[model samples]
Target: MIGRITNQQQLVSAQRNVQTSRALLSQLQEQAATGRAVTKPSDDPSATASIMRVHAQQRATEQYGTNISDGTAWLATVDDALSSSEDILRKVRDLTLRGANEGTMTPATRSAIAGELEGLKSDLLEKANTTYLGRTVFAGSSSAGTAFAATPAPYTFTGAAGATVQRRINDSETVRVDVDGAAAFGTGTGSVFALIDNIVTDLTAGTDLSARIGQLDTHVSALTTQHGVVGTRYSRLQQAAQSNLTQSTALEAQRAGLEDVDPAKAIIDLKSQEVTYQTALGVTARALQPTLLSYLQ
Candidate 1:
C-alpha cells in the first residue's frame, strides 16, 4: 500500500509530535520545581506504595519511642523508692542492734531510739506510696492516690493484687513498668509498716531486739532484689528506644529516596528535554513552510 503521502497528514503528525514533547518538558519543569520525583500516585504508583509503607512504619516506631520513655520513667521512680526504703530499713537494723546490746540500755537512749524508729516508719511509708506523674509507681494500674493507705490501721495495700501496668516497646515486646505494692511491701499484719511498729513495741517492753533486726534484714533483702529486677527492665527499655531511633532514621531515608528528586539529575533532564522540544518545533516549522503555489491546490 505505497499510497501518495498527503501534506495534511504530515502536518497533523508533526503537530502531535510537538505536543508530546511540550508535555514532557512541562513535566520535567514541575519535577525540577517541586523537587519530588513522584508528585502524585499516578506519577509512580509502586514507589508511592512503598513510601506509604515506610511512613506507616515510621509512625509506629515513633510511638514505640514514646512508650519506652514513659516506661523508663516509671522504672526510675520505682528504683529510687526501693533504694530509699532499703536505706531506711538498714538504719532501723542498726538502731535495733544498739537497743539489743546489753551495755547501752539507758532510759534516754531507748526513748531516742523509739522516737527515731517512728520517724523512719513515716519515711518508709512515704517511699512505698511514692508517685510518678501523680500516679503511684508501685500501684500496678490502680487509680488510688497512694499505693498504701496509712489512715486505716495495719496500713493495707491500696493497689490491686495480680494487676499490672505495662508498656509496648516494640512489635514483639511488652514490659511491666509498675511494681506490685503488696509483693514489695506486704499488707495487713504482715506489712513492713506493721513490722516497724511491732519492733517499737518490743523495744519499749525491754525485750531483746535481735529478732526485729532479722526481720528488718528480710525486708531490706526483698527491696534490693526487686530493685535489681527493675534495673534490668529499665535497661531493656533503653535498648528498645535506641533500636527504635535507628529504625526511624532508616525508614525516613528510604522514604526520601523513593520520593525526593536528585537536583543534578533533574537539571540535566530539564535541559535535555528543552533542547529536544526546540528542535521538534524548528523541524515542524520548516516542514510546513507555506508554498508559493498553494492557491492552485
Candidate 2:
C-alpha cells in the first residue's frame, strides 16, 4: 500500500510537470513565431501598455517629419520668387540710370527707355503675383485668388492687412512662410510701381529727371537689402530641413529596434522551442505508458 501511494503521487507530480511544460512551450512558440511577447492583454497586460506607448511615439515622430517636409517646400518656392524679383529690380535700376543721363540720350531715346521700363514694371507685378501649387506665396492667409489686386492705378495688395502665416519647424522654432506683399513690393515711397510711374512721367514730360534717378537708386538699395534677408532665412530653412531628415531617420531606426523582430533571432528561437517541445512530448508519452506490473510475474 505504501509503494502504491508513492507511485500514485509520482504520477500526479509528473502529470502536473508535463502540463506546465506544455503551456510554457506553447508560449515560447508564439513568441518566436509572432515576435511579440504579448499577443493580447490576457497574455501580458504590462507589455501591451508598453507597446501602445511606443506606437504613439512613432506616430508623433512621423507627423513632425511631414511638417518639416512641407515647410521646406514652401520656403524653397519663396526663395525662387525673391531671386527673380531681385533680378527684375536690378534691370529697372539700370534703365532709370540710363534715362537720367541727358548728355547721351535724346528725347526719343528716353521715351523708348521709358516704354521698356513700363514693360519691366508689368513683369515685376506678374512676378509679385507668383503662385505655388495653385496658392499665392505672398497672399498671406487668403490664398483663394491673386495676391496683388490689379486696378487702373497699378498692382495693389488686397489680401489680409496683417495676417502672417508661420510654419513651426521645431518646439521653439517658427518661420514666416509668406512674405507680405506690401512689405516686399513696398507700401508708400518705397513702392516699385510709384518709382516706375515717376520716372515714366518725368521722362515723357522731357523734364530734368536726374533727381528722380537718386530715388530709383534708393529703391534698388532697399530691395537688395530685403532680398538678402529673405535669402538668409531660406538658407536657415534648408539647414533645418536637413537636420529634420536626419532626426527622422534616427527615430525610424529606433522604432524598428523596439518593434521589428530580427528574422535570424526568431528562427533560432523557434528551433530551440521545437526541440524542447518534442523532448517534453517524448517524456510524457513514456511516463503515460503501462509498466511491467501489467505482465504476469
Candidate 3:
C-alpha cells in the first residue's frame, strides 16, 4: 500500500530548501564583497597551494633584486677606483717620458718632476685603498681598516689574501663584487708604489729610465685587465636583474589568477542567488499555510 505524505514532512522539506537557498545567497554575497575567489583554504585547497608557492617565489625574487642592486653599486665603486688609478698612472707615464729626456734635463727640472711623481704615487696609494660602505673593496674578506699600509717604503697589502666577496642574484647565480688588491697592486716590494718610488729614484740618479718606463707600462696593462673583469661582472649583474624582474612579474600574474576574483562575474552570481532565495522564501510561505477545505477531508 502507498503511504500518505505527512504535514510535518512537507514543512520540514520546505524549511530545509529555504535554509539551503539562504546559505548559497550568503556565500555569493561574500565572494562579491571580498573580490577574492578563495578567501580561505577550504574554498580551494589546490589553488591556495599554488598561490602560496607563487608568493614564495615572488619574495625570493624580490630579495634577489635587492642583492643585484647592492652588487651593482659595489662594482661601480670598484670601477671608479680603478678608473682613477688608471688616470693617475697615465699622468705618471707622461712625467716619466718628459723626465727621461736626459738630453735637456737640469737639476731643478729633475727635482720638480720627482716631486710631482711622488705626489702621484701618494694619490695612487690612496685609490688602491678605496672603501665602499665602510669596507675596503680590495681587502678581500679581511676586517682590516685599509687594503694597503700607508707608511713605509715597500707597501704591504693589509687586506685578506684570499677573500672573495660574492652576492647571490638568483637561486643558481652569484657574482663577485670585489677585486684582488694584491693582484691589481703588487704586494711588498713588487707593488706599484715601489715601482713608482723606483722610477723617482732613477730620475734623481740620472740613471737609464727605460727599464722603469717599461715597468710602468706593465702596471698600466694590469690595471686595464682588472677594469675589464669588473665590466664583465657588472654586465652579468644587469642581466640577472632583468631576468628577476621578468620572473617576478610572471609569478604575480599567476598568483592573481589563482586567488583574485572577477568582480563582474561575482556580482552577476550574487544577483542570481538573491533571486533564487527570494523565490524559495515565497514558495515556502505558501506551502506552510493551512487550507480551509482540508478539515472536511
Candidate 4:
C-alpha cells in the first residue's frame, strides 16, 4: 500500500512539472512571435503603459503635421495674392512712365490710360480681398467683410488696423500669415494704391505729371521689397513642410516598430511552440498511464 501510494505521488509530480513547463513555453512563444510582451493589460501592465505613451506621442505628431500643412496652405494663398498685386503694380508703374512722357501722348491718350489705370485698381482691390478657406488673407485679425472697403470714395483705408492671422509653426514660434491690405495697398505713407491713384489723377487732368514719376518709382521699389519678403517667407514654409514630412515618417516608423509583428519571426516561434506542446503532451500521457502493479493492487 505504501509503495503504490509513493508511485501515485511521483506520477502527480511529473504531471505538474510538465504542465508548468508547457505554460511557460507557450508564453515565451507568444512573446517571441508578437515581439511584444503584452497584448493586453493582463499580459504586462508596464509594457502596456509604455505602448500607450508611444501611441500618444504618435497622435500628437500627426496633429502637428496637420497644423503644418494648414499653415503652409494659408501662407501659399497670401504669397499668391501678393504676387498678383506685384504684377498689377508693375503695370501701373509702366502706365505712369508713359503718362510722364506727355510730349508724345495726347490728352485723349492720357484719358485712355486713366481708364486702364482704374481697371488695374479694380483688379488690385479684388486681390486685396483675397480669401483662403473662407478667411480673408489681407484683413489682419478682423473678420470684417471687404478688405479694401471702397465706397466710391478715393484714398481711404477702411480695413482693420495692424497685422492679424498669425499661425503657430512651433512650440514657441508663430508667423503672421497675412499682410494687411492697408499696409500693402491702401492710402498711407507707404501705400502702393495711393501712389497709383495719384498717377492716374494727374494723368486724367492732362497734367504733365513728370515730377510724380520719381514718387511712382519709389512705390515700385517698395512693392518689389515687399515681394521679396513674401518670397522668403514662402521658402521658409516650404522648409518647414519638408521637416514635418521627415518627422512624421520617423514617427510612423517608430510606431510600426512598437506595434507591428514580424511574420518570419512569428512563424518560427509558432513552430517551436507546437513542438514544445507536443513534447509536453507526450510526457504527460506517459506519466498518467496506469501500471500493471496498480491494477493488481
Candidate 5:
C-alpha cells in the first residue's frame, strides 16, 4: 500500500536532523573549551582508568623520592660525626705519644699534658652525643636525646642492641639510615670516654702513656669503619633518588597522554563540526520553505 507524504511529516523530519547536528556541534565546542579529553568518566571510561593508575604510580614515586632525601641527610650527619671524632682521636694519640717520653717531661709538662687530654675528652664527649633534629643519630631507633652520657666515671651508650632506623626508597629496597652507637663508641666501662679518662689520670700520675696508645688505635679504627659504611649508603640513596626522578617524569608524561587533549586538534574538530551544523541548518531551512504546489497537494 502506498501512502501520500505530508508537508507536516517533511517539516518534522528536517527539524530533527537539524537538532542532531546542533548537538554534535555543541559537544565539539565543549571539547575545545576544556583542554581535557576526558573531563567526565563517561567521556572516556577506559582512558580514565588508565590515568588513575598513572596517578597512583606518580604518588608512589614521589614518596620514594622523599625517603631517599631523608636517608641522604641522615648518612651525611653520621659521616660528619665519625670524621670529627676520628680527627680528635688522632690529635689525642699525638699528645699521648709526646707525654710517654719520661726523660723530657718536667712536672709542669706532665700537668699541661693532662689538662690538654682532659679538654680533648670533653670535645670527644660532645661528638659521641651528637644529635640530629633532637634525636641522637648513633642511637638507631632509640628516642634518647643523646647517645652517650659522660656524667659518671665510666660513660654508657644508651642505644639498644640490634635496633636500627630505616627508610624505604622503593618497592624492593630499604636502607638503614642510623649508626650503632655501641659499636662505633663502645658501651659500658670499655667506652672511648673511659679510655680518655684513664689516659688523663695516667698523665697526671707521671705514668707512661705508651700502653694506652693501642686502645686509642682501636677507637680510631672503629670510627673509620663506620664512616666508610655511611658513605656507601649515601651513594646508594643518591642513585635511588635519580631513579625516582626518572620514574616520576615518565609517569607524568603517561598521565598527560591519557587525560589531556591537544588544543590544535580540538579546535580543528570544533570548527569542522560547526560548519557541518551550519550546512544542515541551511538545508533544513530550504526544505521547510512553503510552496504553492504543496498547498494544492
Candidate 6:
C-alpha cells in the first residue's frame, strides 16, 4: 500500500525551500554590492584564510618598505656630510701645497695660510658633528650632544666609540646608515683637527711642511674610502626599496584574487535564486489550495 500524503509536510518543505532561496539571493546581492566573495568566514573558510595570510604579509612588506625609506634618507644625510668634509679637506690640501713652497714665500704669507687652515679645521669639525633630526649621525651610539669638542689644546671626540648605528630594513637585513665621527675624522690629539693645528704651527714658525703634506694626503684618502662605502650602502637600500614595492604589489593581487568577487557572476546567481524563490511560492500555493465544490453538493 502507498503511504498517505500530508499537506502539512508539503507546506513546511516548500516554505523551507523558499526561505533558503531568499537567503541565497540576499547573499549574492551583498557580494555584488561589496565586491567581496567572502563577506564572512562562514561564506568561504578556505578563501578567508588565504586572504588573511596574504593581508598579513602585505602589511609586513609595507612596514619593511617604510624602514627602507627611512634608512635611505639617513644614508643620504650621511653622504652629504661626507662629501662636504671631503671638499673642505681638498681645499686644505691646496693650501698645504702652497705652504709647502715655503722657500719662495714670506713669513706673512705663511701666517695668512695658517689662519685659513685653522678656519677650515673648524669647518671640518662642524661637518663631523652633523645632525639629522637633531641626533648626531657620526657619534656612533653615544648620547653626547655633539661629536667633537674645541677645548683642551687640541679638539677631542666627545662621542663614544666601539659601536655602530644601523637601521633594520627587513626581517633578516640590517644596514648601517650612520658614520663614526672618530673613525672618519680621528680622535683626540690624533684627529684631523690636531693635524691641521700642527700644520698651522709649522707654517707660522716657518718650519718644514713635507711630512704634514703626506698626513693630509692620508686623511683625504680615508674620506674618499668612506664615501665609497656610503655610496654602496645607499645603492643597496634603493634596491631593497624596489624589491619591497614589487612584493607588496604581488601580495595585494594575491589577496584580491582570494577575497574579491566578480559582480557579473553574483548578478547571475542572484537572478537564478530569484526564479527559484518564485517557483517555490507557486508550488506551495498549488499544493495548499483546497477543492471545495463537494461541500455545496
Best by lDDT: 3
- The candidate that achieves the highest TM-score relative to the unseen native structure: 1
Residue-wise lDDT of candidate 5 within 1-297, one digit each (tens)?
Answer: 999779889888888888888877777777778877777788779998998898888888999998899888888888888889999999999989988988998889988888888898889888888887777899887776788877563677877668898999999999999999888888778988788888888888888788999999998998888888898899899889989988998998888789777999998988888888889888888887888988877
Tens-place lDDT digits, model 3, residues 1-297? 998877678889988999999987887788888888887888789988988898899899999999999999999999999999999999999999999999999999999999999999999999998998888999987888788895663698998767788999999889999999988888888998898888899999998787778898888998999999999999999999899989988988898899888999999989998999999999888877877654443
Question: How much does each candidate deviate from the true structure in C-alpha RMSD?
Answer: 2.3, 3.8, 2.9, 4.0, 2.9, 2.9
lDDT of 2 by residue, 84-157 (tens): 87788788878877877777888789879999989988887787788777778877877547776657435667
TM-score of each: 0.90, 0.82, 0.88, 0.80, 0.87, 0.89
Model 1, residue pairs in steric clash: none
After superposition, the stretches of candidate 4 with alpha carbons farther than 4 Å from their true spots are 1-37, 152-163, 188-191, 290-297
Q: Is candidate 1 or candidate 6 better by TM-score?
A: 1
Residue 280, candidate 3: alpha-carbon lDDT: 92
- In candidate 6, what are the lDDT values of residues 1-297, reduced to their tens digit? 997656667668878888888888888888888999889999989888888889889888988888888888888999999999999999998998899896787988998898899899889999998988787888877787788888764667877676777877778999998887877888888888889988998888888888888898888888888889999999999999988988988988888888887778888888888888888888888877765742332
Rank the candidate models, highest TM-score first.
1, 6, 3, 5, 2, 4
Score residue 163 of candidate 3 by CA lDDT.
75
Per-residue alpha-carbon lDDT of model 1 for 18-98, expressed as tens digits? Answer: 999998999899999999888879888999899889888988999999999999999998989998998898898888888
Q: Candidate 3: which stretches are off by over 4 Å?
A: 1-23, 289-297
Candidate 6 error regions (>4 Å): 152-154, 289-297
After superposition, candidate 1 runs with Cα above 4 Å error: 3-12, 289-297
**CA lDDT, candidate 4, residue 110:** 90
For each candidate, the alpha-carbon lDDT, in order, equals: 0.88, 0.73, 0.89, 0.72, 0.86, 0.85
Off by over 4 Å in 5: 1-34, 285-297
Q: Which should have the higher TM-score, number 4 or number 5?
A: 5
What TM-score does candidate 5 get on C-alpha atoms? 0.87
Error of 6 at 70 (Å): 0.6
* TM-score, prediction 4: 0.80
